[model samples]
Target chain A: MTVATAGEFGLISRVTARLGAASPLVQLGPGDDAALVAAPDGRVVASTDVLVEGRHFRRDWSAARDIGHRAAAANLADIAAMGARPTALLVALCTPASLEIAWAEELADGLAAEAGKVGAVVVGGDTSASPTLTVAVTALGTLEGREPLVRSGARPGDVVAVCGRIGYAAAGYTILSRGFRSPKLLVEAHRRPQVPYAAGPAGALLGATSMIDVSDGLLADLGHVATASGVGIDLRRSAFVVPEQMRDAATALGVDPYGWILAGGDDHALAATFPSSVRLPDEWRIVGEVLPASLFTAGDGVTVDGRRYTGGAPGWDHFR
Target chain B: MTVATAGEFGLISRVTARLGAASPLVQLGPGDDAALVAAPDGRVVASTDVLVEGRHFRRDWSAARDIGHRAAAANLADIAAMGARPTALLVALCTPASLEIAWAEELADGLAAEAGKVGAVVVGGDTSASPTLTVAVTALGTLEGREPLVRSGARPGDVVAVCGRIGYAAAGYTILSRGFRSPKLLVEAHRRPQVPYAAGPAGALLGATSMIDVSDGLLADLGHVATASGVGIDLRRSAFVVPEQMRDAATALGVDPYGWILAGGDDHALAATFPSSVRLPDEWRIVGEVLPASLFTAGDGVTVDGRRYTGGAPGWDHFR
Candidate 1:
């Protein structure tokens, strides 16, 4: 979009018009120094992500609605990764003035739509004219009377499990890279991810030790847990679970399904170290184990027998 | 600055090296799904603002320190405007990968420096590679037992007052626009504004009827109060209590001093309407009264010797 000077209808003004107080948690909305939210509990889990046009997303590849959904999703995923219930989001947008008003409205619509999915609200935001479009979203969540699941809590014998889809966004990227229109399912996943919002809080309830969301590839993100916890991780590849459809899609693209399962990212799946005795939910696929050493390698029959998963996975690296 | 690919030792990794968990509010800093914050009050006052490379600032005109300070100040000012005690800030930054690590470090220093002034901390943030630099900050404030001051409660005959500098930014812009590089004070004022952080909670304590920050010139922002609260506003031109230093600067530029006071934006001073009997702060300048009607006009303002003061105040107009 062409860059225009700040118009009569600027971003901050438009934002004030499009929303109102929609929840009890939001005691105040846009027109204040800060929004007063009913935290109910004393602790708040907050996360922020920056999405720049031509970097995090391409406008040509995604709709304005998708941008809004994805923008909120990115930060919401972070809150979930911390094993916290998603609550409210504050967005800051810098867009070229000449961009269509409809783009922004649709983005707001997408924002509201996605926010409604997790029972969260858009509390406050700021906007201004800029050369390129940029969105910064901050998500706040409540712990609801529980200790936060930190990345440094994993132990030697904990079970490694994952909740929600893995590799869908990466698979979708392959379609985009090949210049082929993704099947409706893959493209939808690429635009707005379906994060297990309940799973984070649930994992905490089920005694999750160290946890993280698969924003970067599973291995890279889990690598963080291992590094932080001072332990090694060993994956059992044979025990890996993939839906029939995702497996079929990987087969059709002539790519190794293991890569998507092992390295693909942005599915926002919840991965955690659970106690060996606990029974994980059917949605959560158990595929690995925590070990004593500080290494990431394959175990008995997985990618293993002897193979080691060295280096980082091919995920969304901001600065490679 | 050259644009580096994802593989370069870009900002995210560099920032990771410079950062530590220095604040108590930040339970989790970087390298986690999201940061865990201690919302001890069970309520949070949140606000967000986006600063672009050109529209909000100029790299050539301001140092990286000033840019960082200004960016954090803008959002923190919003929290202060809300009658909330500033607590922590989450920053999402997009910059050219080749931008000096020292520049990024200085920017971080600037953010921390400003946050320190208000007793706030940088709890969480994300960095990404982008062509042009952009900074978006989401400030979280803790309202320690106070009702938030909003812009929808003004009443007729309420005394309107401003706490802090009004036209200094505009005056500085005039100097910058005229290629005057010798003066340091005007440039410093333009780059780093000293917002009255404590005045907001004080105003709230004094039972302010309505409030807003003077980000968009005094009259223009006050216009929002008139529009939202459905009250007319009239100012006393004779009540101009501007400092003498500003007068000298305006004279040096051969520009009308009232123009800066009226139309210049980005001062971020607090403007509120309170009962006439309220004890005023030293920083506050009594400027006008809330009228009974719904529209704003010159007749509502103060006159000198039976004649209206016709000196023009070019309230900042975004469209213009």
Candidate 2:
């Protein structure tokens, strides 16, 4: 049945039922006007992102479940980047009146599934009718007695490390846009990224000085760290040899795999900087080095093997 | 310059500069992937709402500043409804690429204005290009060691009280739609509501049993409280006796002022229940009585002076 037939209240009731039980941190859940969640560390890390239909995702390219999962992953990755354990998510979904109730239910299922992976809960949200579909998610996380890892602390002489795969999403985008149906894994990675939820806290425990989530490509996100920390990041190309999964898609499209890895957005990997003296954990791959700001050159903010990236676009820019 | 011309990074830099300095609660602010805020109560209250163009507001009817202020007010009202003191807001704005940068700046100004009223800050948010304009805001609040006042606690003997104006927005909406330009205040009220931000916590301090924000009209919101509390609310029509402001609009439009008083939405007033013996604060007006669920009639949900409402629609329903 469509949402109109079910009515707003009925649709909300159905969605609430499918979201399962609330986490212990949630003092009050959806039935209330607002959800109350415990922030035991006396602090809460918060972030939000809005996804619009046709602009953020297309129905033809992504299923409802994929859209929901991706939205949750994107926001959760923000919290994780702050060196906090995600605790809750609040979603605001606006859809056309003709949308199917089942689609909304499936969306809720995907949000719950992705949130559960990080031991978080969908505490509360709002739904409304609109001319197009839009999903806005706010993720809240706890510091758990640790100081937050911000982007402004990547000092020179720090080792740059990453905790998950990058560039798969961009590769999948190329494949889907070009209508190449093979290489199911890359396509799945683009549609629904499985972010490394534990890697953030692990890095914080390992004394990561600064961290960021690779939502807007390795070079672009690291550039933010560079600008904030007043440092330059030099990535080692040898440490980033193209993985076998991306090589198949790259060869099929006749494009450089490096382009995808350097400029891909939406992979949601944790890119962090640690002191050179600290021993890196097994989960982290030392891929680059942090350099002093004086070493940076104009128009070559982030370098790979001491050379500028030859990719067509530096990274994704929504307004561009 | 338009957003496209300014570019995403430049636009973000301009917005950040306009938002001014962060509050002390914000350990980390807008420059990071996420914001870390001190939740001194050891818990955070979170809620979000998405406002779509043409659905939630018309640009022709509202100034950019008014739209931003209303969006922040809508989400902050949710946190207030839970009897929490709002602490921070995260706004997600989606607009066409052609949108002027000045409009975006005005939006930030409005958000900051409303948030500042409650000593809150705009810590972090997202922006993207879309076919139409949309504003999604997530508000976080602190409980400050008090139990949340939910909709399920209104007992039969509780006295229904309201701390802000009702039906003014609906009256203004009617006046605007009818092209009556004489009532400038009412029309302005429709564009930007003045929510009673302090009343939520004040009511809780005064031992409110149940509370809700009047975003969907008094009767409709009361129905939520009634259903959750399993009781019937009998509104005293005499108590409402249309205020002079609404009376002028009703008379100009040739309509009953009672209709707007009972069903007008968007005022964002605080409606709450208190034990009969407690003295009602001067800021709050006594309006009704809660009756046992057994006393409720099959066809009458929320009654006015012991009769079912004969007005057109009880309240707004998104999917209806």
Best by lDDT: 2
List, for all models, the DockQ compared with the true complex.
0.60, 0.84
Error of 2 at B183 (Å): 0.6
**What tens digits encode model 1's per-residue C-alpha lDDT throughout A1-320?**
22244354465566556654387777777665567787677778888988888877888889989989888888887887677777788887777767777688778878877887888888878776666688888999888878888888989899889898887887777777677776767767877788887898889888889788888778777777877787777778787766676778778888877787778777888899998988888978887888886344432112222256543354567754
- For each candidate in turn, the TM-score is 0.92, 0.98
Ten-residue stretch with the least lDDT total in model 1 chain A: A297-306
lDDT per residue, candidate 1, B148-218, as tens digits? 78887889879899998888887887788788853676667788887888888888888889888888777
Clashing pairs in 1: A33-B78, A33-B82, A319-B6, A320-B6, A320-B7, B263-B314, B263-B315, B263-B316
Q: Categorize the docking of model 2.
A: high
In model 2, state the lDDT of residue A175.
91
Task: Please give, for residues A148-229, the per-residue lDDT of candidate 2 as tens digits.
Answer: 8899899999999998878888888889899875588888888898788788888898889999999888999998998888
Q: What is the per-residue lDDT of model 2 for residues B1-320, given as tens digits with 9 covering 90 to 100? A: 99999988878898888898568787777879898888998999988877888877888788899988899998898889889999999988888999999999999999899998998889999998888788889999998988898999999999999888788888878887786754777778878889999989888999999999998889889999999989999999998867787787787678998888888888899999999998986889999999987877664357888877888677888778
Evaluated at residue A32, the lDDT of candidate 2 is 78
Residue B161 CA displacement from its true place in model 2, Å: 0.8
